[model samples]
Target: MPKGFQAMTPHAAPPISVEGLRRSFRGPDGRPFDAVAGLTFRIETPGTIVSLIGPDGAGKTTLLRLLAGILTPDAGEVRLFGRRPDTNDPEFVATLGFMPQRFGLYEELTVWENFKIFGALRGVEGAALETRFRDLMTLSGLKGFEEREAGKLSGGMKQKLGLSCALLSEPKLLLLDEPTVGVDPLSRRELWRILEAMRTRTGMTVLVSTAYLEEAARTDRTMLLSKGRLLAEDAPDALAQTTAGRGWRARALKDAEEARLARALMHDVRAASDSPAAAPWLDAVPHGEYVDLLTAADHTRSGTPPRLATDAPEAHLEPRAPTLEDAYCALTFPETRAVHAALAAPARRTDPPAPTRTAGNPLNAQDVQDAVVAEGISRRFGAFTAVADTSFRVRRGEIFGLLGPNGAGKTTTFRMLCGLLAPSGGRISVAGVDLRTARSAARAKVGYVAQKFSLYAQLSGRENLEYFGGCFGVSGRALRERIDELTAGGELARRLDARVGELPLGAKRELALACALIHRPEILFLDEATSGADVCARRAFWRRIVDLARAGTTVVVTTHFMEEAEYCDRFLIQDAGRVLALGTPLEVRRRAGAASVEEAFARIVTDARRRNAEGFAS
Candidate 1:
């Protein structure tokens, strides 16, 4: 038996305990804010997997840091196995394994070298080190990539290597902070499998934080946090059952009216709340072909679906089995729920269309309607091909998705399309302008939001917006007008004067999108814009994107959330720098014979890997 499996078996005490935890940090405005306020929880069982979930700035990360002995709480106490967690205690440190949101690995080092270094730091060396490395590499599917440079590995591979390093010491307690963020669905499943297997073999306790509610629902226990307080904690099923009667699914008469219908439903719910005889608070969001509705528990409409006022095609409402997300919304404040639903509300019918080339144009396209076109595009760095012979076209006002597993060249391809990187071969055009000969002209018609926050952190949101608007040549009255248009009476308006870094995850995301739209460019590029946002924030973000596409702005986005792919009009899937699938979401689902995009994505990627190992042409 391996040392990791044997090392954690002798201990019998509970892995974690905390009471009245409190932590605070100074905001960008020089004001103190409680990050983890009066939180208390205990995990009594060994070998249990507990999921920590919350919206942005809900103190999930702060709680993890406090438990890891990296941060001292202003108040309250934490006990690991009935002893205080002290950073200077070697025994305590050795028994705990922590992987932060961004795992710190020497990017320039090879996978084997990185593993060896982390092992030595954790006191694992010689034969013991070799055995541990072999076991972890095999389990993580990284055995063959030992010689690969850590920097060159795909996102998924990097995550696996990080996990292996964290686990080198066979710790009894493992802490993973959003370990699966920004990776493909296939990689996410593999990571979870490794976690489950590790717990089974070693009886180690695991605490992980994630934005994916469905992922949290699968854990042995889930703790939902909001505003630095524990809102609810229980087994996943128990928590879900709390919202049993609040969930409903409503489908529009026409499938294409789903978004519009959802907007109308939410709008009616909000408006009714302000009237003399208003209905209870309700949340509505578009879900593929239908609109998902969750009503607050009200005896007036306890068992029957509430009627909503809307000009959209009549919708049929049916009861939906409640999930963890519905439960989360139920516990959240009414203001938060209102903000989410309100932001996603559709534009007023009296408003003018956004200024874009494709506005008022039909979906059907002739050759001249192509907003973006790439032919046999390829980018090679030295001997390695990042993107190979990729070809695709984006129609005007269309939402096109570029998807693939980590390190599969999605970024490279996206850069080529944006005229940020010169492809080694093939032709490309943006907004009818040739990228090869008129790169500057092509770039002028597009706006890009990077995967990471690229705006000035110290500057106020309003200042950042002004700066970006100036760069894009919108100034004086024009820039002010644009800022007002983006921030008028919503979440953005509330956070506009605050420093950008001080804003919560959702507000920061909104600011980023607001900056991207300041120029009203014909094309918008978003690279995982909603990667860490909560469910409500994601729904709000997509609603804005759908509205953009409707007004003739071409949107090219890359996201790891497979369900987000369903929002794309058309998308292409790539792996190992090769195009494996390309078509509408329904078409791809049919090809793989899978029920959901995530399932199809996993099946397709697994099949491709198997074929490659069998020496078949990819």
Candidate 2:
């Protein structure tokens, strides 16, 4: 038995219990603010998985840290197994395992070395440590890679290794903080599989925080947090029942028709002021030529409810079962849905129709040309190839996705397209300008939003926009007008005077995007811009993207969220610096023989890895 386990005491209380938990910090202006304010909750059952769901600044991480005994709460009582959770208590500490958002792994050490260090730290030694380490490696799919350096592993593999380290002591409870934030679909599934197996075999309790609602649904129970307050806590299916009969799907004959139907539905919802009890439109998510809309049954001024229109001439709407995502949206953004409806209405009214090529029109000929083209693009560092023979084209006013796991060459390709890195071989063109001959001219027509926040933290949001506007050659009165235009009627307008560093994660991402679009470039590149954003933030971000594409701005984006690919006209999948698949989302799914883009991506990468291993053996 482990040394710490000998000190542990049995209790008849719940695994976790908390009351009036609070934590505060100093703001950028040296003012005090509360991150977690008077939260009360309990985990009553063991051997079950619970999920913490909330937006960017909802105090999920703060609560986790407080429970781990890493940070002292300002005012609260936290009990683990009926005793106070004190880091100084060996018995209390030995019962829990915590993995933070950023795992601190020694990059220079091999996989096996890292495991040994963690195991020894937990007081496991000799034969016990060796047996535990071997079991972990086998369970995490890292048995063959024990000799590989930690730094050389991919993002997914590193996450798995981190989980193994957290589980070395075999604690009764595991606490994970957003473990799948930027991981690929296949690896994400694998991580969950390992967690589930641990629970089944050892009856260990698991609590995880996540931004993906789909992932939250897989847990036994979900606790929704907002502004550090527990709004609701219940089983996943029971929570989803809150918005039943409110989901609807609409299919159109063509892309243009789908856009038109979406606009008309928005107008109808806006115009129906008589129905005061009706829920606002939840979402207008687009999938190729179809758009799925979610809304509640309309209640008239007399309190009479009316069913949804399923046989309308404009669209074919069918009632669908509610999902965890729908329930979450209804709970979090009940009012913000109106804001989206209003924002999308005017864009549809003013946007021009798709241009058709004509024999006598010069403008039509120019419109037919591709906005971005890459032929045989390749990048190499010494003897290792980063991106190899990649080719893809983005037409004007289209959304194109570039997707792959980390260390899969997606970033390398993105950098070459943005002109941040030079390609070793290829012909690259942007907005009808050749990059090799006139790099400046080609760069001038593009806007880039990096994966991480790129702004002066100390500066105000408005100031950062002004600075970037001037850099893009918009100055004097034009710059001021553009800043006002971008911030009008959204969250940015309310937080213009706040410093960028002090703002919430969602607000910071929105400001970054506004800065990138200051000059109104013809093309845009977004690299994981929605990585850590919440459901509401992601919806607003995509609405802005759709509006930009409607106004003739070509978008090239890379994201880990597979659902986002449904909005793209087309996308390319890459692995190990080679293109594995390229087509519409549905087409790619069909070719991979999978139901969704996420599953399709996993299948493609799994096959590629198998083929590579066979080649090496030969």
TM-score for each predicted model, relative to the true structure: 0.89, 0.88
Cand. 1 TM to true fold: 0.89
Q: After aligning candidate 2 to the native by TM-score, how far in Å is the CA of 13 from where it should be?
A: 1.8
All candidates' lDDT scores? 0.80, 0.77
Report the error of model 2 at residue 280, Å. 5.0
Listed per candidate, the RMSD to the true structure in angstroms reads 4.4, 5.2
- Give every collision pair in model 1: none
- Show the lowest summed lDDT stretch of 10 residues, model 2: 1-10
Q: Report the poorest 10 consecutive residues by lDDT, candidate 1.
A: 348-357
Looking at candidate 1, what is the lDDT of residue 458?
94
The residue ranges of model 2 lying beyond 4 angstroms of the native Cα positions read 1-11, 28-31, 253-280, 287-290, 296-313, 334-368, 615-618
lDDT of 1: 0.80
Candidate 2 lDDT by residue in tens digits, 1-618: 111122224556888899999999886567887889898888877788899998767789999999888999999898877878787877776788888876668889999899888876677778988898899899999899999999989889998998988888888889999988888887888889999878777777888999888889999899988777787789889998887777677776544465455434434444222232553454666544455666643431222223433332356666666777777776766434433432332232122233343333223344338877888999999999999999988988888999998789999999988888989998777766667766796787788999787889999998999889888899999898878776666666778889998887766777888888888888889999989887766765776677678677889999999988877778999999999999987688889998778888989988999999999999
Clashing pairs in 2: none
Best-matching candidate per lDDT: 1
